[model samples]
Target: MVTGGAGFIGANLVRALGEVPQVSEVVIVDDLSTGLLDNLDGLPARLFQGSVLDPDLLDDALAGAASVVHLGALGSVPRSIDQPLQSHHANATGTLMVLEAARRHGVRQVILSSSSSVYGANPVLPRQEGLRPVPVSPYAVSKLAAEAYAVAYSACYGLPVLPFRFFNVFGPRQAAHHAYAAVLPRFVTAALAGEPLRVHGDGRQTRDFTFVGSVTSVIVDAIVRRVTTTDVVNLAFGARISLLDLIAELEDILSRPLPVVHEPPRPGDVRDSQADCSRLRELFPSVRPVALRSGLEQTVSWMSGHVLTGH
Candidate 1:
């Protein structure tokens, strides 16, 4: 079962999981709060239009399920700043609901979608799982709290859970329509429309932008192999690039030179973040996710034809 299956990360994961022949059936649970219906178009998964907060629906979905992927959450740092209570309820409490449901249904494993924002403002390069999670934003706090809950559940109840800490993941299905969309698709859309790409702060902030395909691979591995180690693994490219440089690269891809408009950094935004995925290697020896440029090229090509053509 996949919660927030219609969301950006969740939707891409649904497609990837469906293509896996080993998997028989995939169930999707989403409230459609931030996720769009179009993201789930043409998917073979059983789509249940419900929130994770609904115990009854989750109960039904978890029944006979071998594993569960909890990806549903309010996924915006700035939005979380605006509405801390709502973000806490959705990311923290909602995750608890999924954990409880998985526990009750006798599911063997669950892989949670965690965030890099848990690193906070520490000057640490390549954030590792061992670092103390000093989250700055309410969103980060909620995600960190959820991570703790996942660990606590595993230690206390023996529920097999793995929390994947994903860095700036971007790809084809990412929604640019949302106010709090990720940078890649949003920048792509602006460039395609001949508008100035907006850069927050000085735009020198670096991020390890892992592709969705890479994230999906890690997710599938966690479910299939059940390689439990630190209970948290960084799913990232381990490569960092500044936002300004990333924008320039995207502009070059589009064959159009665009002006970059600088804006004040939004509150609850992190300065820089990279990941140390060495532990993941030790656990899943066969796991290797796609590189950044290859993934970006594919994403740009797909978005140019699909979203730009207005088809």
Candidate 2:
């Protein structure tokens, strides 16, 4: 069972899971609040259209499922800052509900989609799992709380859970027009249209931008291998790039300079973030890191098509 299966990452993951020979069925549970039906086009999966907050709906979705991937959440730092209660309800309470349903359904494993935001503004270069979390936003707090619940469920209820902390993931199918859209998609869309790209805080903030394919590959591997552990692993390339450098790379891909507009950094925004992927390598020794430039090229190609088609 895949929560948020029609979302950006979830939709990509659903496609990846279809290639697994051992997998028989894929169940998708999404409320369409942030997920789009177009993202699930041509996908073979049982769709359960409802929020995870609905216990009855979740129970129905969990029926006949072997494992659960909890990716559904109200994701966005600025949005979470604007609506703290809704973020907590969706990210924190919704995760607890999923775990409870998984436990009730006798699911063998539950994989959680966590975030690097839990590290907050700590000056740590590459964040490790051992560092104390200093969450700065409601979104971070909700993810941290969800991670705690996952660990507790594993220890107290014997439920096998593995939480993966993903860095700035970007790739095809990511929404480009949403108010809370990620930086890559927004920049790609603007650049394709010959519009000025908005840069917050001088565009010097650094992030360990990860590709979506890498994220889904690790997820499918975990599900197919049935990894049994309560460890939290960082899934990233471990390479940090400033926003200015990212823009330069995009310009190089497009063969044209993009106009830039500087703006003040929004609240709850962190300065720099990078992941210590040693634990991830230790857990999944076979996984290979995808280069940022390669991922950007693929993303730009897809975005160009989308722009031509007016999607």
Pick the TM-score winner. 2
TM-score of 2: 0.98
lDDT of 2 by residue, 132-179 (tens): 889999999999999999999999999999998889999999888789
Using all chains and alpha carbons, the TM-scores for the candidates as numbered come to 0.96, 0.98
Q: Which numbered prediction scores highest in lDDT against the true structure?
A: 2
Candidate 1 lowest-lDDT run of ten:
222-231
Residue-level lDDT of model 1, residues 123-192, one tens digit each, is 7988988898888999999999898899988988889888888899999878776688888888888887
**Cα lDDT computed for each candidate against the true fold:** 0.86, 0.92
Itemize residue pairs with steric clashes in candidate 2.
none
Error of 2 at 45 (Å): 0.6
Each model's backbone clash number: 0, 0
